[model samples]
Target: MMASALLAGSALALSACVASLAVGAAGMAARGVAGTPTNNEQAHPAAATDCSTRASHYGKVSIIDVEQRSPSKIVVWGTADDGKQRRSFECSYGTKITGFKLRPIASPR
Candidate 1:
């Protein structure tokens, strides 16, 4: 019957979706097991898409762009809280290459 056919079709579609999700999850797990950064930190070392990361590090700075120029160096450019136009940062990923927090800098330039 048409109703039975429709039910079978729906079941097939659902199975496909579930299988796709499982594959995606497996791929992600493989990447993690292979020692890849899940947070996209490997690519964008100093990138901050929102204010929280900026605020946590530099306090109320509006982060616009972040680029990793070198393995140890990153440049963060954005408008500051006091409305400074060219406020920026050049930071190190820390002693062990763990970029958890921005270290103290003597100057911005």
Candidate 2:
């Protein structure tokens, strides 16, 4: 009898879990159907925090171009400096950035 009761309790718990998963999937689909940014109340870009901020003095950044080299790789080209001088920098993002390619410039753009 105890074994039967345990089995019943296990079945009930599993059912609850399945129901919760279905609800979660439905909510996600509804968000897609609504065609909204989903975070309209938020005042920042979702990936703003993901961007690297290690440039010198946090100088102005202008994205010259962005290219997706692969499914998980992106190449970013731009220039940054602390007003003393300007430099062109290219940053590659994949599993990790194993390189730093920077070239000095005579002026800011």
Candidate 3:
């Protein structure tokens, strides 16, 4: 009987531990701490606007990706009207905007 009681106690403790772990994981996910961006998390507004304005000179620019390189710098990748040509724009807050055209590498025939 004592052995049975011990087994039941152990099972309850294990289950409680697992339940707490599951709850903690769920809470982390809900709080966007699981390495995933929530809906509210997006590229900096000023960075996006600056990139768009600078890239507009190329043509009707379509932004592909926006990445924050640092607290004050953001890099935006995009394609112009042709879509074949890719470009990258780097915007540093309170500084100049730099743009670069990404050239496609020619494959060996």
Candidate 4:
């Protein structure tokens, strides 16, 4: 019980941190301080890139593992449509993503 709680808390913290980092990086770019591409720009390329173009597009995630708020949701992190790093989760039945295999992002072939 305690272990599950800890795991859930850790997951939540990590998710929040990832979100904050992405947002912060975007904010910095918008200011043109570093002349770096903003998150929106990064997201655009990610969207264009096909998931199959990269072998590491899919990964395993524990179905029974996740933060309390999204305990039943399975999270997967990888490149998105814009070719930028992104994370998404789906319900267990939406796909076998939380178990046997994870599906890849579809591309406009």
- For this target, which candidate reaches the highest lDDT against the unseen true structure? 3
Q: Give me the runs in candidate 4 sitting further than 4 Å from their true place.
A: 33-109
What would the TM-scores of all predictions be? 0.34, 0.44, 0.41, 0.29
Writing each residue's lDDT as its tens digit, candidate 4 over 1-109 gives 9999999999999999999999999997877875643223223223223222332344322232222224233332333233542333332211223222334555446
Cα lDDT computed for each candidate against the true fold: 0.53, 0.60, 0.62, 0.41
Tell me how candidate 1 scores on lDDT: 0.53
Candidate 1 lDDT over 1-109, as tens digits, reads 9999999999999999999999999999997888732333464543444323544444556555666655544445554343333234433332222343333333456
Pairs in steric clash, model 3: none
The reply for model 1, stretches above 4 Å from the true place, is 36-109
Instruction: Please give the lDDT score for candidate 2.
Output: 0.60
Residue 71's C-alpha lDDT in candidate 3?
Answer: 47
Please provide, for model 2 over 1-109, each residue's C-alpha lDDT reduced to its tens digit, 9 standing for 90 to 100: 9999999999999999999999999999998897653322231221122233534434765556555555555566767766776777776655445344677886524
Q: Identify the runs in model 3 with alpha carbons over 4 angstroms from their true place.
A: 1-43, 82-109
Candidate 4 collision pairs: 43-82, 45-82, 45-83, 46-81, 46-82, 46-83, 46-84, 47-81, 47-82, 47-83
Each model's backbone clash number: 0, 0, 0, 10
lDDT: the better of candidates 1 and 4: 1
- In candidate 1, position 40 carries an lDDT of 38
